[model samples]
Target: MTNITAGDVIFLIFCFSLAAYGYGVIHYGKKHSEEEKK
Candidate 1:
């Protein structure tokens, strides 16, 4: 089996961070738009 390297761990963290940020943007965007409509 291949060993995991530090670079791979770092890349995984970066990917997860990007996904979380995108999700946050979408979630907040929807909330803001709904509030504006009220």
Candidate 2:
């Protein structure tokens, strides 16, 4: 097996951050639209 380097850890963090940010944006957007529709 290979060793996990700092770069790999950093890359994983970056990917997770991006995914969370995207999901937060979409979720907030939907909630805002639903509120507006009321």
Candidate 3:
């Protein structure tokens, strides 16, 4: 089995962070639009 390196871990963390940030932005935008319609 291959061992995991620090670089691999860092890359994974970066990808996850980007995904989370994108999701948060989309979620907030949806909420704001719905609120404006009310």
lDDT of each: 0.90, 0.90, 0.89
TM-score top scorer: 2
The TM-scores of all predictions, comma-separated, are 0.73, 0.74, 0.72
lDDT of 1: 0.90
Ranking by TM-score: 2, 1, 3
Query: Could you tell me the TM-score of candidate 1?
Result: 0.73
Off by over 4 Å in 3: 33-38
RMSD of every prediction: 4.5, 4.6, 4.7
What digit string (tens of lDDT, one per residue) describes model 1 on residues 3-38? Answer: 999999999999999999999989988878766653
Where does candidate 2 stray beyond 4 Å? 33-38
**lDDT by residue (tens digit), candidate 2, 1-38:** 89999999999999999999999989988878756643
Sort by lDDT, top down from the best: 1, 2, 3
With a 3 Å backbone cut-off (N, CA, C), the pairs that clash in candidate 1 are none
lDDT of 3 by residue, 1-38 (tens): 79999999999999999999999978987878766653
Clashing pairs in 3: none
